[model samples]
Target: MSLDRRLATPALTTLLVVLIGLVTGCARIPTDGAVRDGTTELEQASEIGFIPAGPTPGASPDAIVQGFLTNAQAGPTSAASFAAAQEYLTPAAWRAWDRYVRVLVLDGDPQLVPEDLEEGATSTTVTGSAVVVATVDERGVYTEETDPSTVPVTFALTKRADGEWRISQLENGLMITTGFFSQAFHLTRLYFPTPDLAWWVPDVRWFPRQTWRTDATSEILAGPPEWLADSTTTVIPEGTSLAIDAVTVTDDGTIDVSLTSTITQATADQRALAVAQLEATLVEGEGRDVELSDGTSPLPVPDNAVISTPQTRGDALAVSDGALYRVVGQSLVDLEDAPSLDGLDPTALATGPGDRPIVVRDGSDRILRLSGTGVPDVVMTGRDLVPPSVDRFESVWSARGNTLLVGLASGGVQTLDVDWLDTRTVRSVRVSPEGARVAIVSSGPSGRLVHVAGIQRDADSVPTGLSTPVQVGASVDQVDVAVWQEDTVLALIGAEQDGDRAVFVAGVGGQAGTGGLARVLTGVTEPTWVTASVGSGAMLVLDGDDTLHARQTSSLWPPVAEGVDLVAYPG
Candidate 1:
């Protein structure tokens, strides 16, 4: 990415023979005989290094250039491998190259085009064009830039005393070509403390698998990224950090997280937050426990603390005939007689996250909450308001033509200043379960696009701004967003290529379109609404006829409910 003039082409003819110095490398080749039963040879080999190979002495300029690029592998797991890469560079140029700055990951083989060599010139230009898929920085931060990146690399060369080509001048950092980014890095979610300190916001980050466990915990200690800086914080003591360099997960699945003594004498709430952060960041499989220590005593995660998870889910709750119903075994059981009932006219229901039904009263724009007591208590009261979308932080977020209102579960309202959504006509907003992201389905000059962003919150979990907005399905015309599948499944009501209304799934953070959906259910003419349960993985759709059909991961879906208009699931 650095295009400084000093890095442009200069000289290299005399050293052509040196880059031709392909050194002999040693390796125990893995054959069928090396693998017996369940044992594999690769399992025993260190994944972070090479045996140190270089282009042979007789190789051409293009081959040496390709070899230098494809073989240099300095990154999160192998920052020291650049030493081996130094074998290809002249001693002076190697000393000047800063390998820790940025690592460019290319898509496929780099096209090496040699320019017309000048008469009696030692150096000529070689223009390289390679698609850049992503880049990893020194901090281990990665960004996927799938645009094709082309760079004119200058390789000044000299014939060393041994009479061979050695790269005398080159740019800093390693250039990893070929589609190797996926193999070197993995999608990892680093947990950051939400405003309430009762839950965590999953900031999806990428880490090299070789150093993932260690780097993951360190990332947590470093706190949330810039987008989440306002909405999330660290519960670890202010000065506390990882005393050790790495977090070790034993073969038995026990995670040992060691921190400094700053947390040893911390408050009960602080200690509990520390444990929650560690467990969420370290534990991988079910029932695998996390052990935190300050290098002295074993500290366990507190049992009294509550991690925010919605108890009353939207998929299980339904409404019909001006009455409330809980769906059980495909039956709509009335809940009007449950508790302290009164005059409750449900006009519009807010979906996602809550232990009760949050609806806009028939004649009032005020939001009403009916839970344990069943007595309708006004939570958010205002005029000319739209139905609220219950966010994961136990807060309600509603936007009336870009004028957004965010109310907490406690009892207060904060109208945030969001000028970004003004250009587009805001239709509906749904927050993710992590309470850090907001999924908005809005219409603009380009038609309806799905935008997902981080919900920046104050210390009290009040909405401030929606940051890092990325329009999902930008190329697809989406009508409405049904629900989110935790971090993966994204359900939307859109038209298929043949012009038939259908439900589509774009697996967020992964694949796209029907390729991400488990089964294709088409011919739902004029499909309007969709919802999927986070707990059950059950998906339901409502067509123009108001008929409802259910779909899980399987192809077959029985009619689950009828006479239902609006539907949703917990965020």
Candidate 2:
């Protein structure tokens, strides 16, 4: 989602009044001075101007703890708010605290219980508890907790020499309410190029809205995250850094990025690729351009420099009654000039690179590749193979039992060894359109697990293995299928608890509620298969009754075609 900085009118007005009061209280009036007239100036206030209140003099222990928690919510976005929050803590405590360690998102306000101490006591402890819904690490990666539970928030307050109660000890990180987090931070994606530079892969991150542009650019230069490092590559030269501390946006929406002289060592192609990556990461609205410099000379971008966004063909592919057809405008038309599946008894189908159809035979469990000469060849065989997923590299992915196999278009098959998939039965496997990542659904002792990981490949872009998997949709207990709706969104066919099978939208980097398993379609009668087109944002699902349903804007899934066995978009 994009940045949402809107605040309620009434709330904004109230905050303005509070700020005015604070400013007036700190100003000193000169009553004896003569009235002198000068030019009057008024500056407009920023829409996001809201300074959190500082600690009150002689406040109680619980009051100080509560105030600290409230003010810390704005610490990530505003330096004034962070300074105000430090007022509630002792000198030693402020030094000991590390605000970037972790961010605990709470369901609501925490419960603070202060200890009853004698009137002369100098120190006391306050116990706090809140139900944590999610957590963000120092790198701003958000992970939704599978189960929400009450977590302790303890604080130790001591009376100082000035007869004021200040927090002396607390946790290293800050605790914030979900409402505050939603307003202060935004979920953004950093783009990186694949090994071959054919497509852009997204790496999700959370950043404070006030400094998102600078943060995003710095992260792009720092390289992709560990989980995605092997699959993606960067063109920026090593040791390249921002010449200045911040990235500046001009009045006309042009982004000016000045880099260190290390960028001078890059080749022309490398410089063009670097510019493409910066533009993709920082350009948000129309008419915005990213200009680069080395603090002296301007770096020119190539005229044909282009970074590819993952997109699929407009029409979808489906198999019905042992025949392959192209879905066009609610009608199934025979695929012309393509190999006929007349006698193959195809049950499932997928389109590889260049619209080549890969079919899975009904009873033989063999994957067949249809040639241009109307001949079908068995590429791989298994006891019970899932549907095939083709990547941009012309490699096909499918799983059987706990083993993941890739059928190379150049030659034989190779079995991948995924350490994290130990003993888990592979239910479904789908390669992303960018060919840099793969999504897998499996079942193990912990029930259904949906994971997305970067695809590791060799210098020739051949499948080698997968990076460490990151679990997605942790709350989904019965997931049967998972498809990529976009680079960072997944369409999952699963149910929570004992609910019926339906369509859920899951964000790759964790969403707001229920561990990213937000139900998009309810009352879907046993959705067995699903596919989505990234270009059109259209989704199709195959129900148990052999009816193909398409998603509409009104959240309704109307049947598009009947007696459909499988559906898929070009991968």
Each candidate structure's TM-score, on Cα atoms with residue i matched to residue i, is: 0.68, 0.86
lDDT of 2: 0.76
- Residue 427's lDDT within candidate 1 is 69
- Report the lDDT tens digits of candidate 2 across residue range 1-571: 1112122222222232222211112222222221111122224333245667877788899988877876677677788778988999999999999987888876656888899989799999999788887787877788766766799889999999998999999988877665457556667789999888889998877776678888888888889998999999988888899898799999999899999999988888888888888888888879988888998578877755677887775468788876777887667898776577676767667776557555454454788877778777777998888878887767778888889988888869989989888879998898988889999999999888999999999888888989998888665668988888877878898874557677777778855432222435553578888899875778888999999988765256778889998888877
* Per-prediction tally of clashes: 14, 0
TM-score of 1: 0.68
User: What lDDT tens digits, residue by residue, belong to model 1 across residues 68-124?
Assistant: 664464333454444545667778887898864776665444567755655555554
lDDT of 1 at 570: 52
Residue 306 accuracy (lDDT) in model 2? 76
